[model samples]
Target: RVKIYEAMEAVILGADELDMVINTGNACAGKWDAVRKEISDLVTATPDTVHKIIIETCYLRDEDIIKASIAAMEAGAEFIKTSSGFAPAGAVVGDVGMIKQATKGKIGLKAAGGIKTLSNVLSFVEAGATRIGTSSGTSIMKEVR
Candidate 1:
């Protein structure tokens, strides 16, 4: 973890084009407050890296989902992402709605986690996801085209 933070710091310091930070670990799943605080401190210390927090929705309840979303935004996260894709469940429309409601237009929402089909991607977009993360980006764009 320390190594990862150091590496992130290095990236932030070295890359002039670095514009965002995505936290892709499920280890920070239920500990929303702590995760938010840590990310806030990290970004504050850097002040240039934009933060995105990914909450593993598979292991979180609806309340936790809401809390995490709000906490991330309050902590200065630029985006609230759903799922790290390491657990049983992935991104779902309902969870996206919760995040949207929690953030209330303060931050962008990213829907990832097993999103392969165009219909799934559309569902997330319709539900207020501003970004899509997937290995099937090509296929999805083809469908859109």
Candidate 2:
């Protein structure tokens, strides 16, 4: 319901990708249905656009991360993203690894937030992250030595 409007609004504004936060609260509480529904809503709203569902791994347990990632993929998301950068923690190599393994070369994986180093970004890539998100773009780029 919420993501329906927001995703449509993003599409209207010409967003090439629709990245929406999963119902992290409900997801952590073990309510997989609500989380998957939210992702599904956005996917339906943006059929032709890329739908990235951010699982916000910082607040989730390892099991929850796997569940949420799988749910997002089952609900038709094109990408499973880790974190919104608003939480206390951000994307980790382990989390990315779990997500990558779950995706099984089916959907894309995006690692975002707290990714400040070249090695960190590269590690996520090696873990099969197709996209890297960070606020420290310049410093990360400077590591090209």
Top TM-score prediction, candidate number: 2
Question: Each prediction's TM-score against the native?
Answer: 0.80, 0.93
Model 1: residues with Cα > 4 Å off, grouped in runs: 1-4, 7-33
Q: Weakest 10 consecutive residues, lDDT, candidate 2? A: 36-45
lDDT of 2 by residue, 22-49 (tens): 8778987899998887777778778899
Per-model C-alpha lDDT, please? 0.73, 0.87
Residue 29 accuracy (lDDT) in model 2:
86
How far in Å is the alpha carbon of 134 misplaced in model 2?
1.4
